[model samples]
Target: MEPLVQDGEAVAIEQEAPGDVAARDMLLDRAMGPRWRKKTSQKIRQGRRPADGLAFVARSADGGLAATVRLWNIEAGIDPFGRPVPALLLGPLAIDPALKGCGVGAALMRHAIAEAARLGHGAVLLVGDAPYYERFGFTCAKTGAIALPGPVERERFLAVELVEGWLDGAAGMVVPTGRYVTKSRVRATAIAA
Candidate 1:
């Protein structure tokens, strides 16, 4: 992705690299508070690698992580025919406190969604402020029948279909289906225990 200039500061949106782990965690903690780890969204992302090419980070001109977003592979319950419905789960989009209004977050959102569609994904689901995410086409319209593994505000569960009607009739509890990180790989990357 190309670099974006927000308020005279050049910000680059790029793939989340291995070296970005620590900075990404710190930024997430600061933006979402320590309790963020306990959120239902975290449950679906735990121990999984992000959907291929779907993790992104925004960096300021100084090379500091400014914002981040990732999508994970998930089973959005089942369709009317009882087949597992595949979808992408997007979440924990965090921005540096100082850059909240600088368009960094929006840039990352657009980049992530576009990348997901380009990669042939069918739909994206997320738990977030409807008003904020709606501008990006996220809505509770197709999510009424969808449920997370844990409690989530009904109004906050949303979805945006990349392929029209991809989520039609999707229902039940959303669960993680992304590739799991092996213990050795986790230790080597220091991403988790």
Candidate 2:
């Protein structure tokens, strides 16, 4: 991916390198607070890696991390017609507090979605502010029947079809396809060792 120019400087958007994990988690904690760890979105993303080519970061002109976003594989459960829907989930999009209104965050969103589509993904789902995400073509119209594994603001559930009509009848519980290991299970394993 090419770096985007912002204010006469280059804002590079690139695949998140392994070394970026600590910085990325710190950035998200600052932007989203400690409660961010307990959200329904976090539950689904708990032990998962972002889909191939879908985890990205934006570095500012000074080479400081500026923003980040990731897309994960999820199952929209079985619809009324008994068809299972496979989709991508977007979340934890965080921008540096100092550069909140800068276009970096928006650019990340655009790039992430476009990359997902380019990779042949059919649909994307997210729990976010409808007003803010509507600009990206995410709407609650097709998400009325979808529920997150944990409690979430119903109104914040939204979806966008990467392929035309991909979300038409996607209804069910939003479940993570990733292997989720509970914290207690980890403790139990440690005790048995």
Candidate number of the best lDDT: 1
RMSD of 2: 4.4
How accurate locally, in lDDT, is each candidate? Answer: 0.92, 0.84
Alpha carbon deviation, residue 138, candidate 2 (Å): 0.6
Model 2: per-residue Cα lDDT over 23-130, one tens digit each: 887888788887887998998887666777789999987877889999999987675688888899998899988778778889999999999999999899999998
Question: Which residue pairs collide, candidate 2?
Answer: none
The regions of model 2 sitting more than 4 angstroms off are 179-193
lDDT of 1 by residue, 58-129 (tens): 999899999999999999989999999999999889999999988899989999999999999999999999
The true-versus-predicted C-alpha distance at residue 15 of model 1, in Å, is 0.5
**Full-model lDDT, candidate 1:** 0.92
TM-score (all chains, Cα) for each model = 0.96, 0.88
Candidate 1: how many backbone clashes? 0
